[model samples]
Target: MSKAVRAVALVLGALWTAPNTVIGLLGGVAGLACGAQVHWRPRDLALVFDRWPWGPGGAITFGNVILHTGDALDVVCSTYAQRAAPCADPDIVLADHERAHVFQYMALGPLFLPLYLLCGGVSVRNRFERAADRYAMTGRGWWPWP
Candidate 1:
């Protein structure tokens, strides 16, 4: 990705995930101030912050810090994985899957959050998610549902 496109993605991602970013930044600062160890690494478009595992795995956010479990960063983006062990290169299919989410965010802006929440009913969410997964797996087609 060119620097210009990366810059735009950063801005758009920050905007789309503004609420999460604020909470994440505060959490990160608190973690730092309290002496909670943090591991930072550069990823495709953002930084990955490995915090003490509080749950099963990590979460992907559009913010600067992508939180993850101590084991493996649960989140995967275009070409980055958060882990101490050397991770294999990102699979093109998985990358495409995540790219679809990025596009969804771009298309919906802040509305994406509420819409995503509203779509939480298994059937609806699955429709969208399946489309993305299929796109990744097939390397062709667009999301089937709005």
Candidate 2:
């Protein structure tokens, strides 16, 4: 890859591990404020939990399997072994909503994470939830719970 590409990769990699630095911090905080917790798991999966009050909700990531918690987009599993169970007792009503957000990340690519953070810290959690719901409504046909 070219030097510019490499630099961008490095920057993104660092942001992935921890997004509370420099401009990336702004995004991270925004996401958190919006109730979008960023899970920097070791694997290449970005799980988005749609929890209210910052602790209860659904999550989504891409791997090799799909987890159904009554959501639209399913968490992609990483391997065939993971495909055994499609519905997990995740105990959340918005797994599918979060999954759609995960798709949003996919659409935004690297910029998604940072933007999520910023949104979290900037917007009120409820507003963030509504915004996410709006996105899901148009993109995934799911409405936010009242």
Candidate topping lDDT: 1
Q: lDDT per model, in order?
A: 0.50, 0.39
Tens digit per residue, CA lDDT, model 1, 15-111: 7766655655666666555443555544323344455345454344333444443444433443222122365544343435544554555446566
Who wins the TM-score comparison? 1
Q: Give the per-residue lDDT digits (tens) of candidate 2, residues 59-123.
A: 32322112222223344322211223453323222444454444444345455555566656323
Poorest stretch of ten by lDDT in candidate 2: 62-71
Model 1 weakest 10-residue run by lDDT: 75-84
lDDT comparing candidate 1 with the true structure: 0.50
After superposing candidate 2, which stretches have Cα over 4 Å from the reference?
A: 1-57, 60-93, 121-128, 135-146
TM for every model, in the order presented, reads 0.49, 0.31
**How many residue pairs clash in each candidate at the backbone level?**
0, 25
